[model samples]
Structures are given as C-alpha cells and as structure tokens.
Target chain A: MKRTPLYEEHIRNNGRMIEFFGWELPVYYSSIKEEAMAIRQKVGLFDVSHMGEIFVTGEDAEEFINYIITNSTFQKEDHSIVYSLMCDKKGFAVDDLLVYKFNKKHFLLVVNASNADKDHKWLLENRKDFNIDIQNRSKEYALIAVQGPRSIELINGFFPIDVAALKYYWFAESTFNDNDCLISRTGYTGEQGFELLIHRDHAVRAWNALLDKGKNHGILPCGLGARDLLRIEVGFPLYGHELNEKINPIEANLGWVIKLDKECDFIGKENLKEFKEKLSRKRIGFIMDRSKIAREDSVIMDQEEHRIGSVTSGTFSFCLKRSIGMGIIEKKYIDIGKLKINIGEKIFTAEITHLPFVKIKN
Target chain B: MVEVQDSLLYAPSHEWIRIEGDIGIIGITDFAQSQLGDIVYIELPETDENIFMNSAFGSIESVKTVSELIAPVNGNIIETNEELAASPELINKDPYNNGWLIKIKIEDKKQIEGLLSPGDYEDMISGGNE
Candidate 1:
C-alpha cells in the first residue's frame, strides 16, 4: 500500500487508518460527524497529499488540454481552475479533474489519486499533434486543504495573502515560510476554503504549523470520512461512485462543465451531444422518509415496486440530521415521486429532493 | 481502550448481555461503539417482535457506514431503548449503561453459555481495526 508523506502525522494524531484505493489514509481523527460539523461551523485541516498533480507545459499545451477536457479552455484566464471531465469516444467518463490554467503555455491538472496513472496515460496518448511536455508530478507535492467558514482567517495568520479577495477557482503562486507553495481558492467542501500544494519534504512542517496556528480558531484535523460527507451534502459527484467509465457526465449532473458550443470538436463531443439529446436517466438528491439508511447500489423502486434506478452515494447527513443521498433515477418514473428503496429485505420510502441536500450559505 | 463489564456475557459480534433470569438486557460493547464512530441512528425492533439467535435484528448507522445489529440470543423483544430513537449519540457516550439497545425475554438460559467472558471478549477484539 502507498502511504503519503502525512502518514506519520496521521498516526501521531490518533487517526483511524484505513486503506482507500491502495493508499493508507485516515478515515477520521476524532469523529466523522463532529469533524464534518466542525468544517461547517469552524475550520478543519485535511491532509490531501494522496491527490495527483500533473503538469502540462510547452507552446501547444493550451490547445492540447482544451481538446482533452470536456470543458473548453480556449480563452480561459490565467491562474484559474476549471472542473472538467475526460471521456472516451463513446462519452464514457475516464476521470473528472480540475484544470488549472497557469498561463497560455502552462497548466496543472489535479486529478483523483486512484485515477492518476490512467489519466496521465490517457493524456499522453492524445498529445500526438500538439507541442506539449507532460510530466507526472504526483510524487513531488503534498496537498493540504484548510476548509470551513474560518479558513481565510486561519490561513491569514501564516501568510497574510489577501485570500478573501482571491476569486473562487483561482490560484496564486506564493512562498509559505520560505517554501514555494501554490495556493488555490478551491476545495471539495462547498465553503470558504483553500487548497495548498506544497513540496513533499515540507509537508510535515506545514501540517504542524497549521494545527498550531489554527488552535484558537476551533480547527481540527479531519479525515477522508468527513471530506466525503461534506462533498455529498453539497451534491458533488465522486469519480468512482457518481461517475465512472460507464457513466456519462450528463447523467451524473455535470453537464454544466461540458462545452457543447465550442467550435473545436473535442474527443467526446459528438457522443456527449447525442447522449444529451437522449438523456433518459437523471441524478437527483433524496431523503428517506423511513428512518432506514440507504447506501450505494441500493435499488430504487417505484410505488408499484418496479425498479427504476440505483443509488450512487448515500450518507447520514449531520447537517440535516437525516439520511440523504444522491441517486440516478429514470426520467419516466421521476414524476411518480416518493419512491422506495430495497436495500435487502428492508424497504424504505424516499422523497425526491433537489440537488444539494443541504444548502451552502454564502 | 475498550470498557467491558466484568459480570456481563458478550457476543463475538460485540454485543453484551446482562442476564437477570429469563430477562436479558442487551447493548453493544464499547469496542463496537468506538469502531462505529459517532452513532447517528439505531433501528430497533418494535416491542413484541421475535428475535432469533445469531441473526440480524436491526442496524446501526454512523456517518460513514451502516452495520447490522446481530442478536446474541433468541427471544421476544419486550422493550427497546426508546431514548436512542431521539439521541443515538448516547451509544458512543455510554454504550454499556444508558445506551442499552433492547430488553429481551430470554427463551433459553443455555444461550448465555455460548457468550464469551470479559477476558475472552477483550482477546476477541485484540486484532487490528477494520
């Protein structure tokens, strides 16, 4: 199993370690629900070093990346990040990643750790016609995320960079305690937060410094469990569960990121456009009326007990204090409303709700 | 460190039984509650429902995962810990006392013989955390 640079730090903080996609990481430090609520109310630090970072440089980097991603980045501003998906010719998703356009000639792609090698190989095979130099920098950097309402205040104590003014999805290159750092005003948590990409050797120092500086701000070191719940509460699609090789971005409720009007025909543009026209299934948020908890792969059934769809991600929401989940249901039986889910022998009544089971206050 | 009541009999599934003749009070062990993290919901069997030995009676939902509550002995559910319906975190705080899950009318007293002692129960969970 691969252990990140923060593995020792996690052990020191009494983190409950678990294996996630070959990486040994913390499931939770204190408690999952408490850590999640802390991110909403105060501040939380996450050792996200397992995330993959790939650098694309050279003259034709911009043109190549635009064709690679579903989101068009032809005229994107510098220092901005765009969430996009890379799919196959049949419009099946390979991975969903963040494209950080550093400049016209350079870009950084932050992708899920489990999909790192596959994504890199996918991009490498498609760089034939474009002048680009691709480098896998996943081992070079350790990512840390300071998330919550007080993230800005906590980061200010370390390096007083006007983070409040930093627009969302934008990043700036700066030095933190004499170490080169790339700070991004982006996070999976739907709150005011920042993700710091620092050198691997300097990760421990940054982790200790953040915990010390954030002591007065009610900051706690969280784990992957809390991060998953935070994302689910905000209706974000996880690559494995909500999206996969067989899942299209349209059915995953990520059509907003796919640019259909871009003049340049991307790799999956034609299939995606056709899939959009025949979009039969749609993703949605739901709350189980029964006290029963729903989980992924739980079959969604109509009132007549006919199978309609299946759950993608489900969790007991700490914010709502109820069972909330995201599921892809058939568009035909969606109006039937108030469906039932048969986890096994147990059946639960679920009411269809809008995306984002819980709202994020600005 | 997990707390175990010395007088109570335990099941390998992490359930503890405090027997008083035919009536047995059941709750999850401290080790089980610790493994479960913050308890969000405990689906308890309704009163007068039949519960079988070594079978799933209900489920316990935490923030991350859901685990089935296995019955340690066969009996009818005389009463459930109604307090858990409103406040499930009590299991995390006090799993051995106020957080008892159910009270069952033990159909056979020999069922307690199959349970492990406090020392044996400690040895059971000495393996790595799952």
Candidate 2:
C-alpha cells in the first residue's frame, strides 16, 4: 500500500490505521464521533495528501478545460476554484474535481484519490487536439485541511496575508516556512477553513507547526472517519457512493454547476441537456426515528413492503443527536413523506428531510 | 481495568452475573467495553421478558460497530439500567458497576458452574485469537 508523508505523524498521534483508496491512512484517533463533533465545534487538522493534483498548462489550457469539464471555466479569474464534474458521452459522471484556475495558461485539478490513475490516463488520451501539457503532480505536493469554526483564527497565526480578504472558493499563492504554497478557502466540511498545498519534503514540518500553533485553539488531528461524517452532515456527494460511472450530474442534483446556456459545446453537453429534461432519480436526505444506524447499501422500502431505492450514506450524527441518511430514489417517490430502510435485519421508519442535516451558523 | 470480584460468575461471552438470593445482576466485562470503543446506544430486553442461557439477549451500538450481548444464565429480566439508554458511554466509564445491563430472576443455578474464573477469562481474551 502507498503511504503519504503524514503516515508517521498519524502513527505518532495513536491513529488507528486502515487501508483506503490504496493508501494506508488513519481511520480515527480517539473516537469518530468525538473527532467529528470537535471539527464542527472547534478546529481539526486532516492529512489529505492522498488526493490527486493534476496540472494543465499551455496556451490553450482555458479552451481545453472548458471542453472537458461541466462548469464554465472562462468566467473564473486567476486563483479561483470551481467544483465541476467530467462526464462521458452518455453524460455518466467519470469524476468530480475541483478546478483551480491559477492563471490564463495554467489550471490545477484536484480529484479523488481512487480515480487518480484512471482520470490521468483519460486526460492524456483526450489531449491530442488541444495545445495543452498535462502533468500529474500528486506525489510532489502534500495537502492539509484545517477545518472548523476556529480554523480562520488558527491558520491566520502562521500566514502573513489577510485571510479575511480571501473569499470562499478563492485561492492565493503565498510563502510559508520559506516554501511556495497555495492556500485555498475551501474544504469538504461545512465550515470556514483553508486547504494548504505545500511541498512533499515540508509536510511533516508544516503539520507539526499547525498542531503546535493551534493547540490552544482546540485543534485536533482528525482522520478519514471524521472526514466522512463531516461531509455527510453537509450533504456533500462522495464519488464512489453518490457519483459514479452510471450516474449523471443532472440526476445527482448537481445541475447548478452545469452551464448549458453558455456559448460552448462541451463534452456530454447534448446528453446532459436531454437527461435534465427527463430526470428520473434524485438524491434526498432523511432522518430515522431513533438512534438505529442505517449504513450504505441498505435497501429502502415503502410502507407496503415495496422496494423503492437504496441508501448511499448513513450515520448516527453526533451534532444532531439522531440518525440521518442520504438516498437516491425514483422521482415517483420524491414526495416529502415517510419511508422505511432495512438496516441489517430490522426495518427503520424514516421521514424525508431536506439536504444538510446540520445547519452552520454564520 | 475493574477488578472482577470473586463472588461474581462470568460467561465466556464476557458478561458478569452477581447472584444474591434468587436475583442476579448482569453486566458486560471491562474487556468487552474496551474492545468496543465508545458506546452510543444500548438495546435492552424489556422487563418480565424470559431470557435463555447462551442466547443473544441484546445489542450495544458503538461508534464504529455494534456488538451483541449474550445471556449467561436462563432467567426472566426483572429490571434494566435505563440510564444507559440516554448516556451509553457509562459502559466505557464503569462497565462493571454503573454499566450493568439488567437484573434477572434465575431459573437455573447449575449453569453458574460452567462459568470460567477471572484468570481463565483473562487468558481467553489476552490470547489475541478472538
């Protein structure tokens, strides 16, 4: 298994190691629920260096990205990140990525760890017509996510830039510990945080520095287990569970990012438009009656014992003190009504609630 | 680790039963609680429900997974620790005392002879084979 630069750091923090997306990473330190609650209430640091970072540069980089991604790339200024998805000819999602438009001739795509190899190969094969040079720089840089309500206060102590000036989904290049880094105001958790991209050799120094500086601010080292719960609480879609090769962006409730009216003929544009006209299934959130946890792949059934859909992600939320789940059901069953989910051998009664089970106070 | 009193009887599944007269107090062992991280919820059998020996009586939900608690002797549940329903983390804090699950009226006292000693139970768990 591949190990990131923070593997030793995680071990030192008494992290329970597990294999995820071909990387040996920490699952939890003390408790998943406790760490998750800490991130929502205080501050938490995560070693997210396993995610892929692919750089696209050349004169036609802007036009090249607009042809492949679903979002309108021409409107974004330098050092701005836009969440978009790349789909196939049939409009099936291949991968969901965060595109950082560093300059007019350069862009950086941060993708899921498991889909890195496949996405890199696909981009290489599709670059024959465009005047762009693609390079996968995933191994050269380490990514750290400092998330929570106090993340801004904790990170501001190390950087010299004015963090308040950096808006959401924006990035800026700055020097940290005498090394060039990109600080982005983006994170999977529903909080005000920054994702720092530093060189691989400087990963340990940077991680330790953050822990020492943010110690009094209640910053703890978080793991994948907490990350999963935080993302689920915000109703964010994970690639393997929510978006896959068989699901389209329109059906996945990501239609806001697809700009069909723009004057550009992007890949899968025609199919996505047709799918939007006849959308069949949609992702919805629900709350269980009690603390009985519903996990992924649990079958969703109606009151009459008829199967309707399946759960994509479910957890006993610490913030809400209840169980919540996200599921994709047929359009016919999208009513704000009652549903049943089969967890293990027992069926649980659930009520359809809106997305984002946990609301963040601004 | 909480010391297992010599008067208490133990089950292979890590449950402890302390008998006084015809009534028995039952709870999981400290080893079991430590193995199952943080407890979030506990599903206990209702009062007056008959429980069979060596059978699945109830289940405990932890942060990572769920574990089934087995009955040590045949009996009828007389009472359950209701406080655990709200704050199940008590199992982690004091599994032997405050985390006791239920009180039962024993139907068979002969089953107590089959229970392992505290040393034997420790040997079984520390063997690292489970």
Docking class of 2: acceptable
DockQ of 1: 0.66
Q: Where does candidate 1 clash, by residue pair?
A: none
In candidate 2, stretches whose alpha carbon ends up further than 4 angstroms from where it belongs are B1-14, B19-22, B127-129
Q: Which digits, one per residue and each the tens of the lDDT, describe model 1 over residues A223-259? A: 9999998999999999999998766789998899899
For model 2 the TM-score comes to 0.93
lDDT of each: 0.89, 0.87
Report how far off residue A212 is in candidate 1 (Å): 1.1
Cα deviation at A133, candidate 1, in Å, is 0.1
Model 2 has an lDDT value of: 0.87
Per-model TM values vs. the true structure: 0.96, 0.93
lDDT per residue for candidate 1 within B1-130, as digits (tens), equals 7798898999999999999889999999999999989888788889999899899999897876789899899999999999998889899999999999999999988878998988888888887332
Which residue runs does candidate 1 get wrong by more than 4 Å?
B127-130
Pairs that clash in candidate 2: none
